[model samples]
Target: MALPDMDTSVGHSFGLEVDGIQIKQISEVSGLKMEQDVIELKQNTADGKYVIKKLPGRPKAGEVTFTRGLTSDNSFEKWIKDCHFGKMSDARKGGAVIVYDFEGNPIKRYKLTNAWAKSLEISTLKAGDTSVLTEKLVVTYEQMEAE
Candidate 1:
């Protein structure tokens, strides 16, 4: 057996799901970052030579942004409000960003914990401009795991 082509996967084949909330449609999702900090230390030798060593620090959690066309659906907005005014014990939620194949089978999943909506914004409206109304949501999570 040989190694597979990782690039065979496409970026557009993905979706986001949150616990206890039904996600109808989302056109774009971005800022799913999984990263860590690097720590450097210098050790001084007796001969006046110093050696620099690098170590891994803590994991960093990033805010993910989702954009979708505005509709009658208000679940996302409600969730955002719940997180903003709800008690700390009942606000956080769990969610996942799942990547699927062309056949609709799941290929990868990024599980999130203690996730909550950080912000929500709606596109500016014009008098009679022929444009689609869109809403954007930013979500923050305490931790994430990829599988």
Candidate 2:
């Protein structure tokens, strides 16, 4: 008997892009959730028995958070400011979270639409501390689809 082919691809977490431009040095990505609302319907049958049925309602993708060591790049900060000033047309961006196999081939992709930064936070600074500086960003998206 011959054995069937099995999938053994590993996930790659660091390759991310926004508006087709690659973001660098991202160490962690979290809070990526795709959810759908459930609608319950209670119906009575002719036998006088009531039952509840669950139906899919709408798509509700949660926010995504990115954490990275601070670098010389200020593009993200600029973009956040632009969004704060009500320049949504320019602030909104399309992004993708990609997962690759060990051979460097893309295995999965999560496409994000109309995404904008919800908040940006920097690690606390101390005069004599020797910790690495980091930036954390919270992002919200209008839609997300996995392929």
Candidate 3:
């Protein structure tokens, strides 16, 4: 048997989109995780022997976090407000995050169902230091699917 061909080109985590909006200059994206609960059962068998069995329980999706360089646009702020302060009917929008290869091709995509912003933060500014302003956003969703 022959091994499958490996891709050597470096893939970047920079390109990301949220609900069809292109987010540029993203520094970090994290928390694409899923976990399942494990149920352990203990039983006593014959001859005073003990046995343990494990079973799978419910599955959960973790929160997704995005960090990007701040820009002049207020889209992210508006989105956050919509989730927190806007009309209840307009909140909780579904979105997606696309990961691209170095050549600007989509390699993996994650769909977020009924997502809402849980928290938003801005980087601190200093008078003497030169640094780009950045925004950090954390979002929670009902479900996440890989496409």
Candidate 4:
């Protein structure tokens, strides 16, 4: 039997059912290394602002990505957990998890009473400013077994 194509990278624009309405959501894995990994997501919107970016760098050793309210019973959050847990069977197994919020969503805001909130914010502005905010998700996966 042939092995499943280990997808090292993936990107997609999907709609997640939230509040009984389909909300646009994007997810992506930007960089990867022997040390750690990085993942990103954007949820809820029709405009381009609701998009995720594959950053150009990877995290160092001993790091984890996380999101707020994701532990709750939310569809979007569940999807993300699925991706990281096992659904994303291609991703590096046993790696760090990190979460980010661009517009400060109620769920995963970079704020805490005792925790230090920090993020590497990327400036979306450009010369043409014609870059349409498109929903996209990218991921780097590992080897897969054939069914």
User: Who wins the lDDT comparison?
Assistant: 2
Q: How accurate is candidate 3 locally (lDDT)?
A: 0.76
> On TM-score, who's better, 1 or 4?
1
Q: In model 2, how large is the Cα lDDT of residue 41?
A: 97
Over 2-50, each residue of candidate 3 has an lDDT whose tens digit, in order, gives: 2226854343544556666786777887898766789999998888899
Q: What is the C-alpha lDDT of each candidate?
A: 0.84, 0.85, 0.76, 0.31
| Residue 58 local lDDT, model 1 | 95
Error of 1 at 16 (Å): 1.3
Whichever of 1 and 2 has more lDDT, that candidate is 2
lDDT of 2 by residue, 1-147 (tens): 222258654444447889999898888889888898999999998999999999999998679998889999996798789899999999999999877766566667789999998899999999999999999989899888887
Comparing 1 with 4 on lDDT, the higher-scoring candidate is: 1
lDDT for position 143 in model 1: 83
Residue 62 accuracy (lDDT) in model 3? 68
Model 2 error, position 35 (Å): 0.7
Would you list the rank order by lDDT, best first? Answer: 2, 1, 3, 4
lDDT of 4 at 5: 58
Of 3 and 4, the candidate ranking higher by lDDT = 3
Ranking by TM-score: 2, 1, 3, 4
Clashing pairs in 2: none
Positional deviation of residue 105's Cα in model 4 after best superposition, in angstroms: 25
Estimate the lDDT of model 1.
0.84
